[model samples]
Target: MSPEFATRYNRWRYNLYAPVYDRVVAAFFAPRRRRAIELLAPAPDERLLLLGAGTGLDLDYLSGCRQLTAIDVSDGMLARLRRRADRLGLAVDVRVMDGQRLDFPDACFDAVILHLILAVIPDPVACLREVERVLKPGGRAVVFDKFLPDGGHAGWARVAANWLTRLIATDINRQLGVIVGHTTLHIEHEESAGMGGFFRIALLRK
Candidate 1:
């Protein structure tokens, strides 16, 4: 889809789901996300950046970190994230920024997390490239998302999954690990969870 079309669709779906977004998403991905974060084990004082940080579901769990910036495109989602931050008494600077055009300096952050984001992004390659560009030398990034099966039934399955996801959000089935490898990134850790050949949490570096 065109960028203009994709942006409109994304904003529309997110606004439509804002009322029940937290309940619906948390019920499905919370457990897996917690496990992924544990596996990543982000260190203190690291300049961490969270992309597509919907409702701050992972913010509470990120208390051990020093400085953090959470960015998302949806205003409705960001509002909920603010509330979540208030409730937890945490100070996470929030912004409504495009993932494909990060408004930050190069090598400024220690870590960047594209949690559950790439799958739903309209332009996965552009998004990943931006992440790579902003990452500091030897900085790490963790990508936790679902994609098509590696080989078995991948061709058709990926297409179908992406088609359906477009009704709710824009998601592609390309494995983030492979995509990262194709870019200027190195994989550090990788894990898969869930059936239906979906979901993975991978740690990568640039």
Candidate 2:
């Protein structure tokens, strides 16, 4: 599918799922989300960006951050995220923006939190490249998502299943190595986050 088509389709899908997104995803991924941000270790005065920030699930753990900005394509999701941030008394700059096309200036962020977006975004490489561009030298980005292990191959069945998964939710067969290989960011640390090793939390340095 064309990147434009995939991006629009996923945005519509997530907007439709926004109302119940927390119910279905929040509880299950809460621990992992917190863990990913913990690895990010945002300082009190740090400028942090939450790319693909869905329903503001990461806001609670990021209250200490002074400059917090979040961007997502789904306005429905961002609306909920704004509400969550308000309730938590955290100041957040929430905008409806595409992950693949960040509007921010280069090398502006101290850290970036990418939770559960790599596999879901239409162009993971473009998104990662943007992440790398916007990060300050020595800036950190913490990622939490399910990625096919390095050098791992997806069986025919899994590849077939990926078609439907990509259409509706995420691309399960995407590899972190393949995506990150296109950018200058280096993987600093990686460890199992959940789903019995299916999901991983990784720290990348730019």
Q: Pick by TM-score: which candidate is best?
A: 2
After superposition, the stretches of candidate 2 with alpha carbons farther than 4 Å from their true spots are none
Worst 10 contiguous positions by lDDT, candidate 2: 57-66
The superposed Cα distance between candidate 2 and the true structure at residue 52, in angstroms, equals 0.5
Per-residue alpha-carbon lDDT of candidate 1 for residues 41-110, written as tens digits (9 for 90 to 100): 7888778889888788898688778688899888888899889888987778899988878898888888
For all candidates in order, the CA lDDT equals: 0.79, 0.91
- Candidate 2 Cα deviation (angstroms), residue 95: 1.0
**Per-residue accuracy of model 2 over 81-174 as CA lDDT, tens digit each:** 9899889999899899999999999999999998989999989999999999999999999989998888999999999998888787888988
Measured against the true structure, the TM-scores of the candidates, in listed sequence, are 0.91, 0.98
What TM-score does model 1 achieve against the real structure? 0.91
True-structure Cα RMSD, model 2:
0.9
Q: Report the CA-based lDDT of candidate 2 relative to the real structure.
A: 0.91
